[model samples]
Target chain A: MLSETQEERKMAEGEEVKNKQVLFRNYIDGFPKESDMYISTENTIRLKLPQGSNGVLVKNLVLSCDPFMRLLMQKNDDSGLFGCYTPDSPITGYGVAKILDSGNPKFQKGDLVWGMTGFEEYSIITETESLYKIEHTDVPLSYYTGILGMPGITACAGFYEVSTPKKGETVFVSAASGAVGQLVGQLAKLMGCYVVGSAGSKEKVDLLKNKFGFDDAFNYKEEHDLTAALKRYFPEGIDIYFENVGGKMLDAAILNMRIHGRIAVCGLISQYNLAEPEGVKNLMPLIYKRITMKGFSAFDYLAHYSKFYDILLPLIREGKIVYIEDVAEGLEKTPAALVGLFSGRNIGKQVVVVSRE
Target chain B: MLSETQEERKMAEGEEVKNKQVLFRNYIDGFPKESDMYISTENTIRLKLPQGSNGVLVKNLVLSCDPFMRLLMQKNDDSGLFGCYTPDSPITGYGVAKILDSGNPKFQKGDLVWGMTGFEEYSIITETESLYKIEHTDVPLSYYTGILGMPGITACAGFYEVSTPKKGETVFVSAASGAVGQLVGQLAKLMGCYVVGSAGSKEKVDLLKNKFGFDDAFNYKEEHDLTAALKRYFPEGIDIYFENVGGKMLDAAILNMRIHGRIAVCGLISQYNLAEPEGVKNLMPLIYKRITMKGFSAFDYLAHYSKFYDILLPLIREGKIVYIEDVAEGLEKTPAALVGLFSGRNIGKQVVVVSRE
Candidate 1:
């Protein structure tokens, strides 16, 4: 072992600062609660990267609270869609991080990147492939956690690639005011398609119609008969259904879908929390209408990020596209912010800020 | 009115020969039976074609017994996948017919064709576009009702167009010995795929493995745990699933589907007779696995018949593909043959031989 110099000794001591983290407890049963995860200050950080490693040490700035995280909390994971979080470990998801030290040639010290990371002050990302370097910063850096992140690409892929929408087509989005749905509704509007959105609250519904520019919007909670509500909104039948919430809503959407309709499955927020998810009884419509239902992940479409930005960046700069985010102030509020997602408390994309700089 | 000449009277008397017909009594309940349809020799036919008509008078030779016919017996008919049989009128489906007279330019008298027609001895086909002219007479005319007709094209479209299979890929076909399933298994084998099939009986299973050249075959009815059966066959997970039998089998198929798997929804024979269809519970895997479930109709792909024939005809001539037909002699047995499909009684592509001439 080489002897440490005086400057190295100072650097080593500075690295011993406390690293606060939100640690996931044992696997959840029914709905996840804030108590399912607790804030932990026991773990400390070593800021320097180990030599000859392909890992990069990042200081996490903003963390996203997504519904898919609930799916990861399940004890028995058969889907194996997103990997599960380990017990007594910091929960990982999409976040904006600043590179502290790098061993990989693709990244450098202090580069702003938004991708996958743990919900902690600092994370060692051995898999540099998950991280995409942030280029344009004129928009808020926290936007990387929501609109410019997974939700953005998800909506784009679903609307353009999966739905295969033609101009003047009718588009319906479930969970219309959520991070992905909001963007999907907007994308449909830009394509000159008649767009309708369904949300949980009146406020969210209003946001969908007014802010997101949906042709019409409704609060799904107020409607006693979902199929009737869908029929009333889409009298001609839905051509493209962006399925974010599954179960009865999905059945209703299938019933109202026109011949040769398309359904893009991005997330199932409603079913993720249930011990036993509801069975879709009206799938016979799939055959009758010749509908195509496809499920896709954003990571698969990341290769076309430059193409996505070519369309999205111009929309953002000109205010043609709008994004709504419900942000929690501090890292300590991460658990509550995430737990609130199930109860429909968050108005839009939920994000937790660890640090401003 | 013009006076009837002796020659015109003789021609009209000749056309008055017994027009044997199967008339639908009413919309069905539970299951369809022979009593639901009664043979009527009462309806008379007109021998001379109407002037300025785009119709063709056909002598129905053979009729197809399909599972989709059962769905047409439903009372509500909300799906509208197939048109319902009108009360006191004959049910229409794919059949082999001899054109005795034609007013359409595309069809001529004595032109042997196979297409959609009524379940009667003599019928007028005003919609001649649905008909396909038979080119090859080397094959039996009865083959038009099975191997060369709707079922053949259905299997082709489902396997090639929908499954989008690659050579050496794994394919699992449910209802393996049925009309479409048998052809799908053979097509998969011809593509050099690892083909596995599931049937209801040991006899059908033997046919699938021994005769159809499937890599492996299992009786789904014998297996208590379908997911376990699938896991045993495809340890790595299934790449493509030709979904013929929906319900429990579809649920299991979804559970065993690999990343980016495709499911071609051809028929849901299991759910057709049930008043309330079974609910699919494992749809959550769709989002995680990123699976694509596409439901298509063979009629929509009729334009590609020559393309299907380009591949299918060569296979038939080379003895690379073989088709099995279960013929129920006489039009009197048509009702029993169609109902037999629901109970898994028919051995292969069920056909009702109306007239050998």
Candidate 2:
């Protein structure tokens, strides 16, 4: 569709050169092994910009490594809970990028943006609406992927909007080690509620208590009886349950709920990979306790994005909020970095840097 | 605490009259046997009415035998579902009664009323606010206990208010033969939705198909594979699931629910008596399909009571809506009528008559 002069003409125009992409090796299965994905350079990048297009070209600097990314690596047959990810494609995620060339009206050359871009060195973005220009770059740019990005909004909405937290109420959050859960636990603490968190490892449990300022923390993996453990932690019974893991954990929380308790279901990480999820037996408690349980997606709450940033950015500046990032260097490590989520290899928020200044 | 009226009362007052009473023999469990209850005159009513008190004394003519009454009869420290019925008290239920005497300003002598009275000939009504005076007597008087009363409101609120039905959508109703189910199935039909119902007997299945105009009907007791049976009936998947029975039936319904399905939980009859209810294995289906399963109490929706009556009364008058009544005569038959629900003995709406007009 373009003339032969387009490639040569663009290079002469003083635009930055194109960059290579890291491609997904193949689709994966349950509990993805590190070998399921590998670095490949089969996909090539065109150096010259095409003429008369409204798209923007950007060099990706940082990529987000999330637990949901592993789910995107699985072969999709349309039978799994939520659709599966396809194989032999450039695996895309939330990333921060620097603009090389732009034909769009809003964005210009040398602009920095962050959004759902490619997990590569550079990308030709067809839709510019998804990208946001980096306005507050005083903080580390990588924070945009983990703390200021999807996970940040997720925790904020789940706690404030869905949970409808009240001061002095007891709050329980599951999977307290990961990006969203850690923020939710801290947010609950800030709201003046007695907060307790359940993580998979003792180290995560310690981090939740010491670093996140949670009132109490328990390693669910070490607990023999989850119900008893909850009773021990919350002897008065839980008023709000921020559910990140569904299955027996939900069942245990149901038993320990007080009258008029509320459950805000965010994600079900425990049963994500199972062929069949476990049964929840203690639902009868809902009738007796008169519990109100609701589920919500962060995408549905986009109206509150600006309000969330207005409140969160100032807290970050004042050091009232603390965020941790596990950054892996180079685009080649993106696959293993994503797979590390299921294995709990990352310390706080898992992220990968494709290129840095 | 009467003043000295011994000589004066003997000369002016007539001899005290004793009113007939129906007493429960004792509490019973499981499909209650006939011997569990008997009409015994343990006490006599005071025929001489109290003067100058803002209370009405009524003679109950008809009594509503609800399945919840059976739950009250079970001897337990926790009658968590329904409050416990005292051992020797006159069993109270929703009933149509004639006012024998009244000191209340609203209700006068000879006024016919239907409300929560007693399962006896004479009941001293302290508060008359709860009673709805019977005005339109053109229909069968027993209809107040079934079609025009509690069950009617239950069906209307569960289907319209909770399900939030869209025209031409596929709807599935469980316990399709009982008081609430028959009305819900008919309402769905009137709304132009494809409705399927599940009953306990083949006769009920025929009634749902022919009398109630359900698009399809199945006898759940006869069906071996509930999931397969549902799939066969609703190949396109269910949009609205009116959950009347819980445990295994609820689990089966969850598996067959379509994307963005709504489950209006009305009653869980199956799990009420069980020491331990069955665990639902496919609860994760709710997360995947973005289903909304809300358990609501009918009392919470009292604002819609008049709205329900305005729409439903006209349908009954036009013969477009049909209601069934299974009348069990005499105060002695009260316990058996309630017990009949558990074994699916009484078809349609089960009621008992304590007195003739």
Candidate 3:
């Protein structure tokens, strides 16, 4: 999957004696700039877990590029709810890794797993509870950082669990070309629901319609009036809205919502960079329409992991569910790729490949 | 009970020949004014239902004063969602009435029923499906306009159904002295929740604490920083918010919400009269806290009316639930009573007492 990388970048030249990390330099106010963080080429990593600790020492192969990571780059009161990243340290996020040494009986050295780790070549995960052991490795290993990981389950839970899919219902997804959005569209299609998505570009819109099997998709950047655009796609009104980009898009979605509609608030990418997020004035329609707007994180649905894998693995194996990753080659490119998310540069799941093996 | 009115005001001078009605003068632009409607003292009324029609003719006794009536008075696009009042015609709302004649088997002469009907002395109700026959009369007959009718069911459904109560959740209510708010507080207290309320004035705030048994109360008008005030009271965070008055209160509540908190959005009383409603800028908390904000109407909760009465009627009879009504003297004062809702003039459930009988 990471074909452009050289074998030298994949090798740890000095083993555990030297490490590389993407460190958080300072707190960000608006959109995170690449300069707000930096590439630290020389660091030390302990080869083993400390005594009496259940933590796993891992060699991270791939790092996930998620929009929520932007929220972590800020200075906030009590770290602002989602737990802000500490400045002067490597940022932590979902990544695919191989266990270097495990203090817990459940994992072993060389075990491949995916969960929350650091944006570095090697990470010492203090909390190994959320990590899942990767199996059925017929697909690319980097998929564990994306479609087979948080974003996959997030789309599944958000669509099936939160939206409570009803056959023939009209669904509108914002940020439709993103990691979660692409999968959600396919899942809705599988459930017999009419699915439409809004993306930021024509290429992404085309991918949504052609590759992801979305009923239709429009480039939100091209539409000046989203309310009228939604009306054009959903003349009968939207029954379920998978809200990924909050603000004016959310306001417009609320206006186009039908009675008893459900809005699953997954991610608010549009508001992540704003100093003061946009005011939503169209909420009165929520009462008239009796809409239910629910905000949730995928961590809450991890209990359904086995069931999710049951549904997803077969789809991936049968080519029923397809994933497209925008791979950024090398650890050096990770900072720019993460920054690219805020600017909508990635066409699919933005993943940084640290190694191929 | 029509105690302030002279006996002449209660009498239908010419029986069926003279009917008193409140006619909508015209569509209001912002906030319904007393000039938007007027009382017509001399108008003919039908004494009986037309042949083969399933209509019931009833002599109205009490009319409900609800904030939603303000939306009905405005000239909106098809009244926005809820049906609008027709200009130059008698306005319609919930009322208590005694049947004078009936063509439907579900009702007979002298049957006391309360439901949506003309805001007039006598009304021929064609659709009698939603009307509830008076089952218990130990309480005040005018209670039908407030506690025993729509507001009672609304509060019960909002608290127990929409908010989904637990034994010890922290509860907050905006407009806590009003019809729905008063009962939601009592119900939460009864369910073993620590409930706090926010009202517009000192008197209403006092009523919330002293009369309604709220754990604490505040005058939102006096509090410059609602978020800080909420933080002081709910040092931990709010678990349930019965949203009656939206805008800044809702914004503050979102900031002070605990993980998995629920907000039952019943009405936005503050935004009802505003030409441009204030935007809720802090919905991101909904994601971090995993909050659920459901916007609903009492009309949707009518199926729970029997269960609501089962919970409330005994509370009223046993003196466990107390009610406060700001009763207008007669039908002549109905227009002023209705307009007073926007200014928070009436103390509790604003009711128009048409007759003692």
Candidate 4:
């Protein structure tokens, strides 16, 4: 057994020398076109940790293709608030990885970890704080990239802390099957609130209603009048609106919001690619209804990660919560998988598989 | 004095027979064209309190002409949440009044109060609990109609409590010379914040800077690029936005907000009149910036009313905070005064004086 383990380590080191990488050729202009990225493999990945460093070397397993990554690739003046990603650099994103070697004591050899990993098969992480150790091997490791990772915490913190949902209150969620929205809908239902969600495709809409236990779901793309559709689904008007698609949907949601309603703004995927965003026409409803619309990032709620894990892990074990992953194989498919998110092609949480464990 | 008191009581009884009042002609379709209402002096007002009711009879001294009243005039199929004023009925609003008679223990005969009163000389109030006694007599009685009134508490609660200011942060106020905006700007200044204000007119802009002590003031009507103007004023980006004017101003403010910014939605004056209110075009900024925008009514914060008085009265006495009022002479001018709020015709708070002390 000892001889076999030594041989397996040597074979893994040999494979690490050959780096299979997906590179972002240039920064996206308006909407990310399919032709922007070309996948290519590189040789000579450094297996040993770099000398005099706080960095850890890891083999990437799963990578998340999120809407926020598109914002990072856009060429613009660094709005000075949040730092923008520079061109020609390897696209860095949240991923599940296995640590091959570590110079820091916080992590060790052969440890399974998940965090800000690269799109390539191997990455050199300078900030060890970014990576979180994977505990509990009972569930699928890929779950860390979507359901148990950023999206889960986002829905938990925004809905519970910001919206402060009351039992039997009406909730409206946009992009209902996408990562954050799916969890938000399910969480609202769990909290004893009536949930309604909107998606672009029929499959996603059906998934919301049947699979996720949402009270109602609508295909916003096919609906002629969004406000009427929202009013229909939420007869009493929405008490909480988990906003994912901004623009016209936001305007319509404003009209349908109940008095003293709370709108937890998660993401606005609709206007990400446009040179100029669409306007929200019914903002006065906010005044008459006395609504509270707040926008927050998942990073701000890291303090609640342990708390989120405590609640969600049990739900997952009991099969009370379901997360659908739109998985694409290989690093070469990463770009297309990511681009599909903007066009609403992905029916669920978009994820890319680098290798099968 | 005793003979005069009896004569005044007898006159009050005689005046009850002649109901001089303001009534909505019909539900308004768009921006209130002046012909929407007619003020008529009638015979016989409702003098007696309803049987088995905790109601009061009030002789209104000052009636506020707020922009929100215009929203009540527009016919919405829904109960219009918050109970819209029925068509062809007396327009009810916040005002300062003298209690002519009372069946509630909190109020007594000849006591002064400020509350939700009708747009008329005398009214029979059923929900007398919503009304509160005017404790401080040092300030002008008309102050209850504007500065020391709903708008005052609005600025205090929204800015101080909701925003929770930090020193040296950039604060922006919209409709800066209006009742709420004026106080918001001053309060921001007192918190050691860098404040900028946007008003409709050059005179109002001047008042914001010269009178209200805003660090900078701009006429949003004159500036073609509101987003650019916000970027210029809030170079570091706006940390707090007191949102009184919505539509384009809201869009611009959203775009210019700093990460973790707070926006207090006091009013949406811009969208109140439009058939379909102008949409906010750049709402996507909320997610990136992680802003908290909330809408609140002073009525909800009644628990803090006495504390509000303790804090604000001393500020007024020391001349640390100043107030502005635009008073109309008679109840007959109430319709035009309320309508004037939308057009920016009133300089500060628009109030109609029905009687003098």
TM-score of every candidate's chain A: 0.95, 0.90, 0.94, 0.94
- Candidate 2 per-residue lDDT over residues B29-50, each given as its tens digit: 5555656655656555553357
Q: Extract clashing residue pairs from model 3.
A: none
Give per-residue lDDT, candidate 3, residue B298: 78
Q: Against the true two-chain complex, what DockQ does each candidate achieve?
A: 0.66, 0.27, 0.67, 0.58
Our tally of clashes for model 4 stands at 6
Indicate the docking level reached by candidate 2.
Answer: acceptable
- Tens-digit lDDT track of model 2 for A139-190: 9999888678878887888789878889999999998878888888888888
Between prediction 1 and prediction 3, which has the larger TM-score? 1
Q: Give every collision pair in model 1.
A: none
Regions more than 4 Å wrong, model 4: A1-16, A29-31, A78-89, B1-19, B33-35, B42-54, B79-90, B103-105
Estimate the TM-score for candidate 2.
0.81
C-alpha displacement of A22 in model 4, angstroms?
A: 1.5
Report the lDDT of model 4 for residue B225. 94
lDDT of 3 by residue, A125-203 (tens): 8888889999868988988877889999899889988899899999999998889999999999998999999998999
Error of 2 at A85 (Å): 2.2
Tell me the deviation in Å of residue A127 in model 4.
Answer: 3.3
Give me the candidate number with maximum DockQ: 3
Model 1 Cα lDDT, one tens digit per residue, A206-240: 89988889999999999999999999999999999
lDDT of 4 by residue, B256-325 (tens): 8888888888888777777776767766667767788887778678756777788789999999999989
